[model samples]
Target: MIYDVYTALPTTSVKEVLGTFEKNKIGGVPVVDGKGILVGMVTDGDIVRFLSLQEKVYFTFSMAYVGETEPIEKVLKQRMNTPISEIMVKKNLKTLSTDDTMESALSLLSKHHFKKLPVVNGVGRVVGIISRGDVINRLAKMTSDSLTIS
Candidate 1:
């Protein structure tokens, strides 16, 4: 678990960030500053929300019709290509310690429905990432042990 974490620096761009995430097939990334202190988190939802107003794809629902069709240039003008530091969620970072139990980690995951949780050391530097997939995979492994028992 300690070795399973993925991290991204705040300097990472939206495109590069998404690329790294796609390469790793992860849903989210922790946005850390230069010193590796946890600053904020970025998820796929945030990106979708950011770009949602620009392009009008095929409408899947009635709500899509309600969305304003702003010009791409106008939208871009209003858009703040701010760094992760400016946009990432500052509060409610569900973090875990390196030595914390998996049960505790699972509890945090289930409660917040977070895709990734930062694993930090005593100084609060991120050392790992515990994702929901990681939890599910671990649960599957534990279940396998019980499957053989009874």
Candidate 2:
């Protein structure tokens, strides 16, 4: 479990979040209230989407894919004072419990291609976070243990 979780509040500004990301080198954070209950999730992607107002898309031979977005720095500075609640992912968040299996967490992460999953307690407060990096490290360790030459 990654206990070094960073957090933000709904009232946190877009610039503040971006600065937090820069300082902490994290792509996202959990948005909590005064009590630290998980109210929503915020990511650099989310902020980018909000700043861009819409995403560009293109069609391929068989399918369509979203195109790249504009640089976020200018917009971040322009809308620096905007509250995070304006763009946070607040509805039907996919979360994990402390007792959840690593397999479950990995499956969800793989399916959604999420960078991190918030681990919550029974009362719905975030306790820790599990990231794809954590899963890969653990898998590497397990494989190494099984392949040890004795």
Candidate 3:
């Protein structure tokens, strides 16, 4: 588990979330409230899905015209100000506790196809984050150590 977890707030802007992801080289973050309670989650996939463009068309008896669409850059710029809460996954969040074992973490990650899971405390405060890579690395290290001659 990564103790130094990066997180976002519900009110955080989409632009800020993108910046966090870029700076930290992460694909997703758990959204927390003011008191650091896990509320939702946001990911690159969510942003991509939310920003998918739908082309509109207008037709008349004598002519057909495609509705004008803004460039992606412009569209992104316009959407940057939107709050992450608008796109965050608010329901059905799966989380882990500090006492959860590595096996449990791996099971949840694989079962739900989650890249990461937030570790929360008794009161629902985020304590850390566990990722698939973290678990795999730990397992590899353990296996190697067990195989090595003392």
Candidate 4:
């Protein structure tokens, strides 16, 4: 029942989200609305995919440089300033409820292969995140505490 969590807002820019990710060293964040309702989810992989799939729409700086290859780094940087709402996964989000059993969470984790599951309230407001690391640590601690080393 870890309660402390981090989240992002829909209007958050890709640059700001990247800074959050970099500072926290996290892989993903739940995107919320002004009222803390889950609107979408974003991840490092999402950013990478967005950058990679962008068509090289090079508006020429000059006639001489028309169609000339722009540096990939520059292209990536330019796109990083856009709002995350455009790129976040907003449909069919899977989530856990506050009262859901741990087995249910584990089942979803196993079936979907997600590293973490967002816990939400009845109204789809994010409460916390349950990660694979959290499950493992809790289970390991329980096991170790139950064992009798003679």
Candidate 5:
């Protein structure tokens, strides 16, 4: 329903968005305007791809992970302080209205293979997000109940 969204602003930083995504275990988040309209989306994959293409150094470490970062001050000087607008996907956004049927939502998800779709109003403001996981969870609960009843 309309209660499913975790909203964020477009002005947020790539680093900030990454933290939010990691903490929430979400693939991406909708970037909204003042009126709540969908402006763009930022995904974890986008950040990974952007970083992978950049020059990086590797060092052997006993830990399961290696630290990779450009110094914050140096990064700020290089404008790695750049905002989310630079990296977010701004075109060909797929969205649905609150009035749209569950079948329509499912179809959009199936066709686009999107983990989440922004739910918008007539004026294009984002009201919520419908995710594949949400749909699957709903269906799973329904199936479980039906089995128990039968």
Candidate 6:
């Protein structure tokens, strides 16, 4: 579990979220409220899905033209100011508690194919983050220690 977790606020702008992703070299972050309670999650996939260009088709006399409603640059600039809350996954989010064991975290990550899970306290405030990599590393260390000759 990573105690030093990167997080975003509900009102954080899409541009800011992207900056955080780039700066920290991370793929996703848990969105927290002002009180530090987990509200949602924002991921690179979510932003890409939200920013996908919409196809526009125009039909003329015996002709058709297919194009995007707006230019990609225009869409990007416009969406940069949008709040993360608009695109964050707010419903049916999976999370972990501090009391959860490594087996539980690994089970959740592998079963659901999640890269990371937010660890929260009794009040739902984010305390840390556990990723698949973290679990795998710990397991490897334990195995190596067990195999080591005295």
Clashes of each: 1, 0, 0, 0, 3, 0
Q: What ranking of all candidate models by lDDT puts the best one first?
A: 6, 3, 2, 4, 5, 1
In model 4, the Cα lDDT at residue 4 comes to: 74
C-alpha lDDT of residue 37 in model 5: 77
lDDT of 1 at 111: 90
Q: Which candidate number has the best lDDT?
A: 6
Question: In lDDT terms, how accurate is model 2?
Answer: 0.89
- Candidate 2 residue 1 Cα shift, in angstroms, is 2.0
TM-score of 4: 0.83
Question: What does candidate 4's lDDT look like per residue over 1-150, in tens digits?
Answer: 557777999889998999999999888899999999999999898888877744445455664323445678987778988899999999988799999987888888889888888899999899999888887887899899999999
Over the stretch 45-115, how does candidate 6's per-residue lDDT look in tens digits? 99999888878899999999997688999899888999999999999999999899988998999998889
**Between the candidate structures 2 and 4, which one is better when assessed by lDDT?**
2
Top candidate on TM-score is 6
Tens-place lDDT digits, model 1, residues 26-140: 7678888788888888887876677566545556656444455887666655654545555567787889998999999999988987777889889888888887888899999
Q: lDDT (CA) for every model shown?
A: 0.75, 0.89, 0.92, 0.85, 0.77, 0.93
- What local lDDT score does residue 133 receive in model 1, on the 0 to 100 scale? 82
Better-scoring candidate (TM-score), 2 or 5:
2
The residue pairs that clash in candidate 1, if any, are 5-129
The segments of candidate 5 whose C-alpha lies over 4 angstroms from its true place after superposition are 2-4, 55-80, 145-150
Q: In model 3, which range of ten residues has the least summed lDDT?
A: 48-57
lDDT score of residue 71 within candidate 5: 57
lDDT of 3 by residue, 38-108 (tens): 99999999998877665668899999888866678877877889999999999999999999999999999
Model 2 regions lying over 4 Å from their true place: 53-74
Task: Tell me the alpha-carbon RMSD of every candidate.
Answer: 6.1, 6.3, 2.9, 5.0, 7.3, 2.6
